[model samples]
Target: MTSERFDAVIVGAGFAGIGAAIQFKRMGIDDFVILDREDDLGGTWYVNHYPGLAVDVPTTTYSYFFEPNPNWSRLFATGDEIKQYCDDVADKYDVRRHIRFGVTVEGARWDDDAKLWRVGLADGTTLSARYLVTATGFLSQPRMPEIPGITEFAGRVIHTTAWDDSYDPGGERIAVIGTGATAVQLIPELAKTAGELTVYQRTPIWVAPKLDVRISERTKRVFARMPWTQRIIRAITDNIYETMINVGVVHYRVPFFRRLNISAMDLCKINQFIQVRDKDLRRRLTPDYDIGCKRPTFSNSYFRTFTKPHVHLQSDGIDHVTADGIVNTDGTKTVIDTLVLATGFDLWEANFPAIEVIGRDGRNLGKWWRENRFQAYQGVSMPSFPNYLSLASPYAFLGLNFFNTMEYQMRLMDRLFGELRHRGATTFEVTEQANTAYLDRMTELLGDSLWTLGNCASSRSYYFNPHGEPSLLRPMSTQDAITEASTFPLSDYSFV
Candidate 1:
C-alpha cells in the first residue's frame, strides 16, 4: 500500500475545499492536498448541468465576498458561469496545484498514537495529515427514487445530476418525477420542446416570481473599474435574502414576522394566480405547508409552463413503473418515451457524514449522528474529531446564499487555526460540553423557526433529518453566525 503525508488534507475540491485551501495558504501552510472523486472542481456546478439551470439566488450575493466576478451575464448566473467562477477562484488562489482530481476518499480515521488522521482511498492507498477537512457538500449525493419497477422501465432514464448533453428530448414524451427546485427549473425548459410532458409531484413547492434581468456590458465594465459598486449591489441583495430568512422563516413566532410570512405567501399566490389560469391547476400547484418548510425557489416560467397545452401536472404519487410508462397511485398510467428524475440528494441517509469517519475511540461519525442528534460545535468541530472540520455539517448552512456559509466557515477556520498556532498545539478537539451546549442553544433557537412551529409535516423537506429535527440550518442571522465564528471561546476546545 502506498502512503503519503501532508500538513492537512481536504476531502473535496468544491468551493468549500478550495476556500479551506486558500485559508491554509494565507496561514503559510503549503503542505496540503485536496482530493475529489470528480475529474474537476466546482462541485455542484460541475455536476448539475440540466436545462435552464441557474443560480436561484442573485449572482451579486451568491459569490465569495473576497473574489467578485464582474462578468456575470445576468442577475442570476447560469451554471456554466458559476463553474467558470470556481475555476477562476482556484486559479487565482493557486490551489489547483494542491488538488488531486479523480481520487475517491473512502474514509478517514484518527490515529491516536500517531496524532494524525489516516485517510483511506479507494485505490488501497492511504494519506496521513495533521488536520482533516471534509468539504463534501450537503447536496453531494444524488438520490434515485425508491419506486418499484423503476429498473424495468424500458425508456431512456435521466437524473438531473447525470444529464446527457447530447440527448435532446424535443418532440419526445417526457414524464418528470419531482417538483423540487431542480424540477422547477427543468420542467419549464422541457415544456418548450417535449411532445407531451407530465410532472409527477408528491409535494408542491412555494415559488416566488423571479426578478431576473440581463447585465449589460456597461454595468460589467463599471463593476470591473469600480469594484465597490458591485459590493454595494451585493450588500443590497444579501440584506433582501437575509430579511426573507430572518423575518419570514426564523422569526415566525413573532406576530409581525408571521404577518410578513403571510404576506410573502400571498405574493407567491398572486404570482401563481397571474400565471396559471386554471383554478384546479393552481390549487394542485399550491403548497399546503408554509413557505419556509421547504427551500423555496424563484421562477417566472415554471408556473406558466403548466398552462401549455403539451404540459400536464400529475399530483397522484407514483405507484410503480411499467415497461414503457409509470403507474400512478390513483390507478392511472402515463406512457412516456423519457423518464426524468429530479429527486435531489439523500441528505440524512447518505450525506450527513458522506464517508466513514472514525474518530477517537472508533466512534463512527455517521452512526453517532444517527444514535444521537446531528450536532457539531459551531457546525465545524465535533467532540471526538480532533483537528478535523466538516464544512457541511448540521447547522452549518446560513441564510439562502451558500457564500454566506462559506464566509463564516472561513472565519471560523482562521480563528481556530490561529488559536492552534498561538498555543503551538498539534491537535485540537471541541469539548463535549461545548458541543452539547451548542446543540441545546440551537434547538432552543429553532423553536421559533417556521420548520419547528409551521406546518411542515407534509413538506417532505430535506431540512428535517430522520429524527424529525430541522437541524440543517443554523437558525440565526448571518451576522450572528459570523460574529460567533470569530468570537467563540477558545477554551471550548481542548488543545495539545
Candidate 2:
C-alpha cells in the first residue's frame, strides 16, 4: 500500500491527542491525523464503563482550561459525563475530523534519511509524518493477574476496562482481584447486588471522605452564563489538588509538610473509623504504608460496603484460581460465580512506550529506558527522538489532575514549534546535554518526595517503575511545570 503522509501523526484519539491536535491547529500545523485502536474516541472514558465509575478528581479541575463545561451534573462527574465531555471537546475543536478510530499503531521508527517518522500500523500499511506524538495515556494497557488457573476457571471473567454490561452480578457470588483505584470505585456497587462478594487485595489503598455534591441546575446556569465563574472554581479546585500533591506527597521531607502528611493520614483513618464499625475488618482494610505511597482515592461508600454481611475482604493474597473459585495463600478458598479483575495497567513494562518506538540510530525507546532510566526532557522530548514527543513520558504527570500536565505540554508545543518555524527547521530534538541536565534535576528533586523519603517499600504503587524509581510524577508544582515549559532555554533543543 502507498504510504500516507502528514505533517504530524498523533498515536491516540484520547484527550491528550485531541489537545495536541488542537495545539497543532492553533499553530497553523493542520496536516495531522489522530489514530486510535478503539472503535471511537474518548480513550479511557470511551473504553471503561464499569459501575460506580466517575472522575476521582472534581469535574471543575478535570477539563481543559480553555474549554470549560458548565453542564457537569456533580462535583465529581460520572464516567459517562466525562466521556461526553471528550466528545464535546472534540466536536467543538473540530478534532473529530482528524481522528481515525479503530486504527492500531504497531510502532514508529525515525527515518533519518528522509527526515521524517515512519509509523507502522497493524494493517500492514505505513504512515509518514514529519512529527510523531504518542499520546497513549499511562493507563491505556489493562493488566491481568499472573494467576495459575485463571484461564481454567469455568466462570465469566470481567476486567474493569472491558466490563460486560450484559452480565449482571446480582445475587451471584463474585470475586474482585484488586483494590486499586478502579476497585475502590467498583466494589461498593458490587456489594449492593452480589450474593457474596470477596475482594482479593495485595495492598490496601488509603481512602478519604468523598465530599461529592450534586451540581444544581441554578449553579450550572451561572457557570454557563458566566464562564469566568467556572474558571474561578476550576482554579480553586486545581489549587486544592496541587496542595494535596506538593505538600502531602512531593514535599513530605519538609518538617511542616511532614506534619500535614500525617494529618492527611489521620483524616483517612477518621474516614474509615466512621464508615467501618468492625475493628478487625477495618484493620484489614487500612493501609500500613503512608497515605501518599500510592494514589489515595475518595469514596463515601467503599469502606461502608465492606461492613455489609455479604461482603468479604481477603488480604492474605491469592495463590491461584481454581475452576470453581480462588485459592488464597493461607489455603483458604472462596467460591464465586464471576471474577472481576480490577488489576490495573502494566505501567513500566507494557505501557511506558505502549508501542515500539525506534528513534535515531535504531535506539529502541523501551530498551533504552530499561537499560538506562526513564527520562524525557520536560516529559515531552527525548535526546535521540528527533521531532517526536511522548505525552505520557516520565515526570510528565503533575499533581493529581491530568489536565495540568496536558495544559503545560500544550504550552511546550507552542514554544517548541514556534521556534522550529522561526528557525525554518524541519526537525528538532533535545540536546544530549539538555536531556541529561533535566533528568538529573528531576532525580534530585524526587529525593525530597514521599516516594523516596516515606516508607513506600510495600506500597506496590505503579509510581515506582521496575528500576524502583518514582519517576511517574514530576516533583514540582503545576505552576513550576508551566513556567519551565514556557521559559526553558530554546538552546536545549537543536533545530535542523
Write one digit per residue (lDDT tens) for candidate 2, span 1-496.
5378999999999899999999999999999999999999989998999999999999999999899999999999999999999999999989999999889999999999999999999999999999999999989999988899999999989999999889888899999999999999999998988899998889999999999999999999999999999999998999899898998889888999999999998999999999988889889988889988888999998999988899988888888889999999999889989999999999988998999999999999999998889999999988899999999999999978889999999999999999999999999999999999999999999999999999899999999999899999999999999999999999999999
What's model 2's lDDT at 274? 96
lDDT of 2: 0.93
Cα RMSD, model 1: 0.8
Among all candidates shown, the one with the greatest lDDT: 1
Q: Rate the local accuracy (lDDT) of all candidates.
A: 0.94, 0.93
The 10 consecutive residues of candidate 1 with the worst lDDT sum are 1-10
Residue 215, model 2: Cα distance from true site in angstroms: 0.7
> Which lDDT tens digits does candidate 1 get at residues 1-496?
5389999999999999999999999988999999999999999999999999999999999889899899999999999999999999999999999999999999999999999999999999999999999999999999999999999999999999999999898899999999999999999999988999999999999999999999999999999999999999999999999999999999889989988998999999999999998999999999999998989999999999999999999997889999999999988889999999999999989998999999999999999999998988998888899999999999999978898999999999999999999999899999999999999999999999999999899999999999899999999999999999999999999999
Error of 1 at 489 (Å): 0.3
Off by over 4 Å in 1: none
Q: How high a TM-score does candidate 2 get?
A: 0.99
